[model samples]
Target chain A: MLPEPAVAAGKATRGWIDPRVRLAAALVYSGATAVWQKPESIAAALGFALGLAVFFRLAPGPVLRRLFAVNGLLALLWLILPFSLPGETLLQLGPLAASREGLLLALRITLKSNALLLALLALVAPLPFPSAGHALHRLGVPGKFVQLLLLTWRYLALLEQEFGRLRRAAALRGFRPRTDLHTYRTFAWLLGMLLVRAVDRAERVRRAMLCRGFQGVFFSLQEFRLNGRSLGFAAAVAAAVAACAVLEFGG
Target chain B: MHISEGVLSGPVLLAGAALAAAGTGVGLKKLAPDQIARTAMLAGAFFVASLVHVPLGPTSVHLLLNGLVGLLLGWPAFPAILVGLILQAVFFQFGGLTALGVNTLIMALPAVIGYGLFSRFLKGPRAGALAAAFGCGFLAVLLGGVVAGLALTFSGEHFLNVALALILAHLPVMILEGGMTALCVGFLRRVQPGLLPGRPSVEVR
Candidate 1:
């Protein structure tokens, strides 16, 4: 089964906001935050993202785990950028100098990355995957693309299960993956078999849908209404995002 | 490789988005209504296939399989990979909203290039077929690394070293994927010849 997002189990701000609004807000916020060069503005964006997380009542554990994973890549940047970027040397280590500009760049990246991630988690994570697809469709994304998105989302768990079964079958046959030609060959064949089965299954699925009168269109039962509360939420988010832009570009 | 959010500059991000959008548009245009389900299912399979981790010395690395995907699906690989990246972002938070276009282009463009470079050899003799498969796999990853490196370097001149490091880091995975893709193609050729690109479709009941 696909894991749920790390939203706390209760009424949260996301429940009151429309998914389209939330998605747009997240996109705007992240896009604006991505270009901000000042550390002060980026840090303020982070603070606003944190406030959104709290308002959304996101569970801290899973959110922090995702943040940690993101930072692992940043940590690599921290190691290389400080030494490679040419600027005023803050520290010298055996002929290698850590430049102040590089350090500041790394700091800005870390802040900006965390801020964008937190906003995405707070705004977009609350909606179900299919709901998000439908929201995209309503937001003027191509219908066929949205259909593909929804269908892929529906079958991800099934395909993962199928792969799990294949792995178990291989294991039962005393197959152990190692750093060797035989192991690689075995894995390649396993994946090959999986692809073969997937092709067959896709044929069967297409036929089944055709038998059921499946056209190119997908009909969803979920309807998004723009109520007063959702509008208010949108207004609040727009205001916050506007404030961020001002802070980023002003003065 | 998924480049996390907030790493790329504005122009780089915009250019990536524009290119990805064009690719996806052409891909969607080529896809008929009746083919949507088949494309979606194959995409799901690829998504699952990507999660498989193979041991390398003491650690493991997941498969990219973009070469194989492109070979199988042709131009549809663009939309397929775009959806896959979207699902990854929504489910695992591997990439974020803004970087989606850049990430899609990084993985899918290489897929399309692999198809262009290697699809003809699938019908050739056994040795040539396998060699082409390996080339597809190796070149796809190599080009992906190069594109990613370019994206980073274009973001800032200071990122040149980091970009080079990123390309260097993909070398081992490139070798592994090359071998695996060759064997996978061999297996498909022997078991289900119709599955490979440019082959006559065989009806399987």
Candidate 2:
């Protein structure tokens, strides 16, 4: 079977702060990191993100997992950027040389990515996706988009389980994935079969909804109310963002 | 080819977001309430695509079946990919939140194009569904790679080099996906023809 769903973090996150606040902070922090160009600012953002991670009680395992997932590209950037950039050489590897500009660019990317990712892990990781969707809806994201996000999240695990069974059946039939036509053809059928099954499931879900007197909107029983702690969290995000801005401008 | 955050310049990011927003608007508008659940299911498929993988000689690569999704869902691929990327970003941390608009466009736009090009081919009497399926997958990967490469060029990376690298890296994937898409099409053609596009009566089951 597939790994557990990512939003599983949300289950432990209730009674913290309003998800909307966390979601807003995440957007702002990420946006701020994106605008950041200075190494100092980016470094500060990274530190802030790490601090938030610790504060949010995110375990090192999950954080490291997220880091490793994105590091391949970052590593590639490190390799190419140093040699590709034209500036005073910071270091040289055999015939290849790293320019000051390229090193900065590469470092900037690593810092920004880590900082933003950590921020997201801390802020959004704990928030159940449904609440996040409702938060988005309250924040004026299109109802359709919010609905779409929730639906996708709702079904990802189910579909994965279905596909897992298919894969198991294939493996039992002596299917080992390789660079061969048979493998490709088999995988194709597997995916196609998956779509067919999912389509059928979708119809059942629709009928079930209809039978329950379902309407176009998915109503939630949870109420969203922002309070002092949420306002405090917002202030904290603003300060961190302001710090990033300062680092960008002051440096 | 999910572009991470903080890579592109502000203008480029804005432009990509705008284009993606427009595309998603069209896709979302076309989605009916009855179809919302189906779209969600397809979105689930897209989300799992990267998780499901097979060996590719020296290394393994997961599937990026945006073309198949596009071919089936039409305009809905836009919103579907958008939501999928959002989940991947938050949960998986593959694409960044800031670069989400750009990432969505890179993957979904090609799906839209694939639908336009391959849908007719699948239904035509003369064209083999297999060829159409292969074309849809191969070309979709090619287009997604090229556009993503072009997007990187806005950040001052060389166009040809980036595009070439992206495409070349996925060359095996393209061929593999092409074969897979063809097989999927063949299977659907036989068993659940109603689920595919260009069918007048949508499958009840």
Candidate 3:
């Protein structure tokens, strides 16, 4: 799975951030953002993002490039929003009038999007999937929900792998569906087959869960210890948030 | 698609969270301990199901399978849906942490209602299954779009325009998802009727 590769990269590059620490950081970050206003809060977020980038050992060039590629179209949407939204025009471009208020609003949204994207990259991209799941579970996410998270994490790669195999098999068989009709028919058959297999697999998984005395909640053998360092980490996050709040209020 | 952070305000997100918690509490009270294992399995199934994304327009929309969950779990659909969305948000980052409750309620509430309505009204097992599945699927997507629109509106984005846009976008998706769910439920009913949710007395009968 790509998760394995990502995890390996994270371990080799960035030190393993205990799920607990990450969870604490995320909570603090969210709370701080919620409490504080814009500009100063935005600066705090950027500072956090920078810190996260360093701790996670992320290559900014690569991650930022990837982020831009995925979200580039969204930027275009902002470009149109200014012109399309009614109000006072600040700038005139040929036939279009860009409203000052609308442009500012679009800019605000764009910043929000970028911040969110950066936060996600800093958080999940570096954290191991299992660790992230465990962290969420520890944070009082319901067992059933955690299990779903675990299964999705476990199966997404497998599903992609399976799809790849099926695609290869089709290629080998020289099965080419030309028109939309033929394509839909092939897709339907594929869908039917996938369902059959999924059902069969689910039965086995259910049986396995039963055998393990799965008491609705999945039990993790690894327990998170809230040591001095963790507390220190939490304090640091809190301090940073406090400083951000002060700056926001002071400003 | 997943709504990002800060898109919805703190109040709206908190409200969704509170509602979701209430739903889960009710669901838990109704469910027996023996049902826990089944719920866990279904949660896993729901997670896996979404990964099988069928193409819709430019972006591919995955099956929510909320309808199937309702048909199988009935009132307990709340907890199952909650678990499913929690996993989706954490593992896949499909939605934001704050928005998890909103997403779950939007997707799961319909399934719970569908189960209540269809299970009582429908005659045969196959008919019940089809009705539940189709209804849930159709409504779940519609609700998802609606909720997204609502969130956008709350954020000071366009209300009617956004709502209309979402509804129009999801129209074709609803038909496709509804049809697939109906067929799946029909097949499941024929092959494994026991999988369908039923009271112990019904099994005895």
Report iRMS values in order: 1.6, 1.9, 4.5
Task: Report backbone clashes per prediction.
Answer: 0, 0, 1
Q: Worst ten-residue run, lDDT, model 3 chain B?
A: B196-205
Arrange candidates by lDDT, highest first: which order? 1, 2, 3
Q: Who is ahead in DockQ, 1 or 2?
A: 1
Could you tell me which 10 consecutive residues in candidate 3 chain A have the lowest summed lDDT? A1-10
- Highest-DockQ candidate: 1
Q: Which has the higher DockQ value, candidate number 2 or candidate number 3?
A: 2
Candidate 2 chain A weakest lDDT stretch, 10 residues: A2-11
**Tens-digit lDDT string for candidate 2 (B1-205):** 6777767866777788899999999998898878988899978976675677678888888888888888889999999999988887766667778888888898899999999988876754424667988998888888888888888887775434766777798887888777777788778877787777885332323
**Which pairs, if any, clash in model 2?**
none
**Shift in Å, residue A193, candidate 1:** 1.4
Assess every candidate by TM-score. Answer: 0.95, 0.93, 0.80
Tell me, by lDDT, which candidate is best: 1
Candidate 3 regions off by >4 Å?
Answer: A1-5, A12-18, A34-37, A84-87, A94-96, A142-148, A155-218, B25-49, B52-64, B75-93, B119-132, B157-159, B198-205
What's the true lDDT of residue A8 in model 1? 26
Pairs clashing within candidate 3:
A145-B83
For A178-213, candidate 3 gives per-residue lDDT tens digits of: 433444345444544444455566667677777988
A195-233: candidate 2 lDDT, tens digit per residue? 888889999998998999978876656688899988987
